[model samples]
Target: MTKTTFTGQRHPAASTEAENSVNKVPTETTMNQGGDSSHLSFQLTSHKLNGKNYLEWAQSVRLAIDGRGKLGHLTGETKKPEPGDPKMNAWRSENSMVIAWLLNSMEAAIGKPYLFLPTARDVWEAVRETYSDVENASQIFELKIKLWKVRQGERGVTIYYNEMVSLWQELDQCYNDEWECPKDSVKAMKKEENERVYLFLAGLNQEFDELRSRILGKNPLPTLRETFSEIRREETRRNVMLKLDSNLEGKNIDSSALVTAKNENDKKKKPWCDLCKKYWHTRETCWKIHGKPPNWKKKGADNRGSQAFQSSSEESGLQPSLEVPPFTKEQLELLHKLLQSQLQTSKLDPSTPTCSFSQTGQGLGEDDWQC
Candidate 1:
């Protein structure tokens, strides 16, 4: 009267429902242990395959898959197990996970057709066959033209060098030739490297003209890497020099502007005299009100006029006249008083006859008074 469980052994007349439930249990368990849903949903690369970027996209996919230790799934190194093998369910789960990663890393349009591929290898091979252009002569030719025309125009040395190196690597993939002899291969590589060095030098901006000439003048040309490093160092030096020159120029402009402003302010601050209608002296110091002093004529004459007078006197053999001091204020007052007293005396004495002052300060006649 004991009941039998299907887990122990499969009966010869096992029902379809019992077989399906048994198969589902192990498949679900294997999927849970071998491939998490998160792992299947993860995007392999930031760049999606869009037919044109097949080489770059393939490289990314390979790196991502290899990192996950499931590269053998795509490479066919992990062969499929026969039915009923203990590892068959785990292998299936992992393969399905790899397929999901591939689809997730492709463009929607490019990935849709490959969605139902039977295996990871099938999907990878199919995509590669459709997009790989390794043998396209026209593409190689276009790349060569672009490499020759690439210039450092307004770009940093690092960025320009990176761009050139990427192009060179792509070209290398297209022309991967194998030499039978090791020595011949090394010689060919040297020749190719020399050409690359020339191309790199030729593509630099005019500012590196002198450095490029020096690099080219060497009997044994430097390697491409050595040439790049040398040029990069030169670029760094030039940038520093330019920055210093700019700073010096700015300082010079600031100093000159300050000097000009100070001069203008000094001119504006000078005293103005209303009486003399001149600058640098006020009405209190006007020469007209103070009367002329000793050497006044010489002081009034400019340097050029004085020099001309001196030269003329030397030529004529005449000594320059000595400067005479003007009359003092006390003497001027005394002279005025004497003139007034003399006029009064003349009025008082009719016999003396009225003495008249001369307007020109000279005696009009022998009886006239002169001052």
Candidate 2:
């Protein structure tokens, strides 16, 4: 050895290489090298293996995987290689990623069993084997019975239709494709469609009878979705009409109450006088206008004469005379006694000659003045 080449520090080239390695950006493969890395920005659809909803759960999970572009991994289409194969590590890495996705998509309570499965395909197969069609006939029969009993009770057309749709989807999931021939499949599909239409029509509330008939009467019958939309619009129209009617009724009630209150107030505030044809005072208090005095007939001669005099005066624009009431018999007797006393005093005192009594034929008689 030509003297061992030793230095206090590493070569510049080695140092540069180390620096470059430290500064390198992670590639997609390296970022996902850990088999269970998740890159999704959202949570996946969750499924539960609660024994009764296996079909629905499986369908939902399958849809979830397909939506995320990882259906191939779950279906065994993108298969993982066996151990010791050249691409075994890569295969296992991808398979592990798929298995992690599936595990995340399961509900916590029922997901414990499938958590340790090696591959997504294995997990799917295990779940399917356990809950696929254990009681195919009975399950299908029960689903059919439920579909048959489905009704619109209390729910609006839209809600009822959505419920029916869920039942139909569940019924469809129960079908097995292995034993279905093209003829039987087509026939079954048509029959199911017919049943669906019938169920939808039958379940509708009576308010939608005419619409239901119209939908059924179409040349090529409308799909369940189209029918549902039509019924929703009808419901909206009914609601609007009901609101209008309610508003009208409220207005009417308010108007009637106001009228009644106004009438009552008018009655209380101003009583009517029928005799005067006026509203200020009642007939009882309007005696001056409507009633005659009880002694009017006894005082009629003076009253008539006074009325005639007033009429003449009013016609000629002269001053009116004062009116007087007729006197009673006792007053006349007192007047006669006073006049007799005056005569006796005149007799005693001769200074004043005795005045003679004279009757004026033109004037009113004394009897006329007496009551």
Candidate 3:
């Protein structure tokens, strides 16, 4: 009798076990390779990664994994195949891609030593062990101290809020996991949120004191997100009001300045007359008796005497009347009849001179009479 080694096709009783193994391995291989084509396209960058940013680095790595549809690999839900398994090549390819991306996404100083890691899980675990443990106690302490001392001086509301948010995030990644007991998961989260609200309020500028008090005065304190929103709105409103006020004040100042300048210009253009005690015309250009005659070119004692005489005559209403031309016929007849009637009634002769002016100043001399 010739004995042959067991082959699944020739030995019908062993066919079931062999067939099951064949089906399982190819299914695993197909699943892993199906998404590998897309995963190779997304590359990770080391933008914010430092030795101290393990949490941020880990978060970025997860996002990359999720983008590539490889979250199962990151969570360790998809483990490496055993030796000689048909799916082993596909499993190794998937894990190696993850590991490569992880190394590329880290700072060169922090990643160079870990570049030779055999799997993604190994690299991730090593980083966590280094940066997420007692080894980072000092760094965590520093971050906490900074958070405590942070202030909103000179910074805008959004900028200060963002900085505080960054501090809170880094602090959480450093100590939240280690200190928060697993038993108080939900309660611890709530407490941590409240603490964040208080910390944010405490670091705000004094200008925000009233708003901060309003938030704290609530029976149930507000969330950080809500607090930030309210503060941003208030800051915007304040800025708008200040700008409007400044613009209005600027317009008012400009108007007042223009009025003042016009008044000054008017004063400069007007000429004061000292002789007449009036404005708009100087003494040299005045037309009143107190002013020099415009046509009087010569200056001498005669001109001075004429000016004085003109001024005195004007003051005394003694200006000479116009010369009498030949009398009209009606005026001469009336005067002749008046003379004949006067000759008949009066005793004095017409040829004799008579004084018509009153003696108001001094006794008149014989030659001072006028007819």
TM-score of each: 0.62, 0.58, 0.60
Best by TM-score: 1
Question: Which digits, one per residue and each the tens of the lDDT, describe model 2 over residues 1-371?
Answer: 12111121122343343344323323344556664434532234444457666755665566556755778887778866677889987777667666765566556666689888877888988877877764378877987788788888787776677666666655555554442356665565556566567778887788888888888888667655666678899999999999999999999999999999999998878888877778887888786766776755653353454565566677777766564535454665566577668788988898865653322222223232321
Clashes of 1: 0
- The C-alpha RMSD of each candidate to the native structure, in angstroms, is 18.0, 21.6, 18.3
| TM-score, prediction 3 | 0.60
lDDT agreement of model 3 with the native: 0.65
lDDT of 2: 0.64
The lDDT leader among the candidates is 1
Candidate 2 structure, TM-score to reference: 0.58
| Model 3: per-residue Cα lDDT at residue 43 | 43
Stretch of 10 with least lDDT, candidate 3: 3-12
> What is the C-alpha lDDT profile of model 3 across 1-371, one tens digit per residue?
22211111122222333343223322233445765364443246333358765655565566556656777776678888899999998888888778777776777787898888887778877888886733368777888899899988988987787777666655555543433345466566667678888988898888888998999999677777888889999999989999999999999999999999999999878998888788898877777855566577553333333344455566777772223324454664575577656655555665644333222212222222334
Judged by TM-score relative to the true structure, which candidate is superior, 1 or 3? Answer: 1
lDDT of 1 at 280: 90
lDDT of 1: 0.72
